[model samples]
Target: MGAATTRATRGRRGLPWLVVGLWVVLLAVAAPFAARLGDVQRDRATDYLPASADSTQVAELQDRLPGGETTELVLVYHRADGLTAADRATAAGQVAAVAHRHTLTGTPRGVPSADGTTLVYPVGSNEPGTDEKKRDAFVADVRRLAHGEGGLTVRAGGPAALATDASGVYASLGGPLLYTTVGVVAVLLVLIYRSPLLWLVPLTVAGLSDFLARAAAYGLNQAFGTTVSGQSAGIMTILVFGAGTDYALLLVARYREELRRHELPHDAMRAALRGCGPAVLASSGTVAAGLLCLLAADLNSSRGMGPLGTVGVLCALAAMLTLLPALLVLLGRRVFWPLVPAHGSTPVARRSLFAAMGSSAGRRPLTVLATGAALLGALALGTLSLPGTLKQLDTFVDRPDSVTAMETVAAAYPERSAQPIEVLTPAARADAALTAVRDTRGVADARRGRTGGGWTEITVTASAPPQSAAETATIEALRHRLPGSHVGGPSAQQLDLRDTDARDRTVVVPLVLLSVLLILAALLRSLVAPLVLVAAVVAVWGAALGLGGLVFGPLFGFHGTDPGLALLSFVFLVALGVDYGIFLMHRMREESLRGSEPAEAALTALRTTGGVIASAGLVLAATFAVLTNMGLVPLVELGFVIAAGVLLDTFLVRTYLVTSASVALGRRVWWPGRLSRAPSAAPRRVPEPVA
Candidate 1:
């Protein structure tokens, strides 16, 4: 018997080493690919556009012109007061020098603003073509050469310059974003575990998962020419840490409970997996499914985000399920150190905080449910205060040189468009297109600029500022008036972004809800329970967005809401909110399966899972909250909404509202399941506690 026991001990030790060995191999193979992920990230405006958008077609066609995609810029030379002749000469000489230095499309044309304090020079070149690197370099060199002196302000602003600045911000986010997220998760884990060694295991595994996610993303880009925007990549990293850590917490909590009941570490680990594995798997599946529904989105960034997010979640799930358990088991019970759970220990028991809350909720279920719903509804009304669609200039939290220059130009030249609308028509219809463009209602100026590869490029200047309703209408009118010609440019791109985001929300929202509902129904085998979860999450989403409306504009002083915020935030909130719901509901189902009364089961489930779920919620919310400190408004807005939604879902929805609803509905919550029917009178087999 001793020999057999020794052999079993050896067998138990063998599996963890094998798991660690496999991961080491995976890390070695994946490191090189992961490091190269940043190299493949694309942040160009067109990268985010819908595949069939007119602006997308314009971008594609321009890449075929003689010089390829044109890198256009407006050099705004301004002074607060009226410009002197010398200032004018300085601008002209600089423009001349720029013209001499590069192969410009035409001599830089100086368009004096009506205020006379600003002189704008529109510069164009195809030399940089479709290459983002060359284009950024060109913009950088121009900015260096045109530096403002004395009272003069010389700034490089336009679509190309704006793109470069935005890309720069995206590129810079990798290091800070990663470090902040890691630090956030680490601190949270340390506090939750209170064991120096225990917290490190899950954190380390999550780090490995991030590496694996990056490597997988790089592979996707290589194989499918996937659009890996900086936004999508950053979001992917967030998911890896946020979702991964949440899974780790759940596993660790269960393992701790199992350790107190089981003698051997191996047995404890196995039991722990049985306790929480299904819930974790269901939560991860729900997140991945909801994200994958982005495959139906027309926008390139949104579509790519679906896969990258799925990769992040799956990688987290894989690492948490495998490496975390293996590491914990290998380290044995001592990993918990000062707080170790000794074998077969039954200590003094007391009601936990969640237990008290659940008891209160159970006592007055309908009142609690109605009150929570009312609060959420009131918050949802804040959506009415949300600002209009954000303009490009307001994308960043801190204004870059391009934004400053554009603002200056707008102040100086309110009546004329500083940026031109680009239209591409078939070479055969060039004259007719030009005539139609000039005759358009808001046309300030129309000129045929370049003709090549069967297409004619027409530059039409609008009478209003960029992204204004008037300018939007003008572009639409041009599109209507110019048959067979594609109207595009910077303003056109923003319009397309707004329109496509709206369309994507309409399609993807329903799909996400349906997929999540299906997954929950399959996992729990209850139609009513799944509906309740979905409806709760939907309320959380609305309340969260409303909270953003109250904060983003009034409290935070943001200019406008991002065009993609609605769709992305909806997907994340609904999907992630349901994760906690699954945790609680899964536990509730387990109790009911053990023949406990429905109301009793609801309270018991909350008592058992509530603390861990709260920790998971805080960790997830805090990790995403890191983005609120990011420089981009879109990142901040997205982070705020998701984080706020998570908090609402966690402390309010899952804690109070869901519990109340479940207790009030009783067995009907599990309609069609065996547990829904009346309990039979038989020998009562009390359920063993998870511990």
Candidate 2:
């Protein structure tokens, strides 16, 4: 098979300048169209979440109600001494006057808190159109006027203001992260390769892959009508760089090894492609397959992420096979300048940490395996305390605009400031149902609005945040207690999100496992090997989740689990963790076929493949660790867990569990029609080393 692959590569040796030219032409044609797609989505948020869901109600309520476009500014007026009624009334009148003169719609709807310390104004926008910039300007103007006037500390926050704040944070954090990641990759490559010319190779390939991915994603969006965001753009960057570098390392490492094997430069290149190419292709396929499975998720954001990530991985694979090889072929030996040319004299003969670790694990497989399992089990204990809340406000660290606005509304008008949960009763008993709901548990107030004909809108304002579990339970109770009514509101929406995410996890995990198992089985032609690898991966996943829970629960006070955690964790663990296992098992099979006993083959495979796995792990982990600096908690947690998972897989599972399992299974590892007959155990003279 290796010889056949070598022959296939040897058949094509010329520089493929035409391919490069075509790539250039494609990019040139796609860039403008891609930019236009982004613009269309940016112009219409409703295109993502259509307000047609409320179109009828919005039109009916348009005349009698205060306009919903107003951004509420919470002005907390505090005095060192207790506030007099005169002071309260004076502040309210002043607020109303300013609001009236500024063309702020309606009067300042002032509601003083129970303690009379804080006053809230539910102000609406005078402008008819809902322009975000105008709303922002109004908030800024309100803030400027309120400052130091009445010894008041005016904290203006709402959806618009919070989004503005988030944008600022993203802007501030994004530049440094980009520079840092690029600089780190550049410096690391230069240091490792020790050649300035060679250091630029991966970055160039990465940039091209990124360009292709963006262009492809743009095309996909147009074809499928998907919306991509700046957030997804960040994810795309990490995926391209991480996956591209991994593929490049595999090819480069193999190329160097082949060159050392006394093969001519061109032969070595081809040989490297033959040996490493299939493994690289297989690894990339698994990643792409895993990412594409995200399409099963109900959320548009999750669904969008699937193809975006898949495009990045596929682009990386394409660049690796085509662009990277072309560049290497053009540069030839110059790619490894200044380093004495390496000769392949028994690649695993030299003593190193990986060799030593592999020898130990091979000698004491049981002890090593048992210890690793125990440690992972200890970490898994943290999963017991995992919370199941999906509060968007919790994503913010402190005093983010959305949270502050929510708090302000809660303080000012406890009854009106809270978001309502709609309880839809049957039209036949709509009036009777409304009376029952008003008396239901946790209901602060209830109002029934007729939407013409027979349909009625029963709005139940809860005394808690719409996303709180208590609110969730309250909504559920209302559904059960008022069994005749249809319950749908912010609370109902939260329930829907929770249920959908749960369903996605249940469905996607098995699909990812099955896909990985089938890929492994096809590659190894051994049912047992794939099943063992899958089991090891599942153990690794459980350990990762447990460790993640410990870190997030204790350190960050993240009591409530983000609903996305389980699904994201499963994907990362299965996709990334399986790579190390594949590398180990592939080499084990190769060594086993080379006339070594199962245990000896396990040791040899471990020694030969461990360094590659570790190096790949470090490179991948470092790239993922960059996510920690993105100012998003989910990304931070993901970065940590994924980085840790890769490290664990390389050092523990692949090195220990896989080796032990292979040794224990013996020749049976190739059960159900052996792919290759095991070599006879006969002593043979060692041939002179190549070169």
In order, the Cα lDDT scores of the candidates are: 0.90, 0.67
Question: Model 1's lDDT to the true fold?
Answer: 0.90
lDDT tens string, model 2, 1-691? 9999877666555445655667688779867765553343322112222222222223233322344333434455544344567667666766765675577645666666776666655555545345545655666666665543455445555444554555444444435655666776777677667776887987888877877787788888878966575455566667788778878877887777777775456677778888878888888888888888887775555667788888888988898887887777667776778763555545434465666776777777777778878887887787776655746555554446446656656655554435556665556787888888877777778887443344555767776666666777777778778764566543465466566667778888888888898898888889898888888877877787787777776786664665666787678678877777777788777766667777777777777677667777777777777876665566667677777777777778887778877766777777763634555575232322111
Off by over 4 Å in 1: 1-5, 680-691
Q: What are the TM-scores, per candidate, against the unseen true structure?
A: 0.97, 0.84
At residue 571, what lDDT does model 2 achieve?
86
Reference-based TM-score, model 2: 0.84
Determine which window of 10 residues in candidate 2 has minimal summed lDDT: 43-52
Q: Clashes in model 1: which pairs?
A: none
Deviation in Å, model 1, residue 151 alpha carbon: 1.6
Q: Return model 2's CA RMSD, one decimal.
A: 5.3
Per-model RMSD to reference: 1.9, 5.3
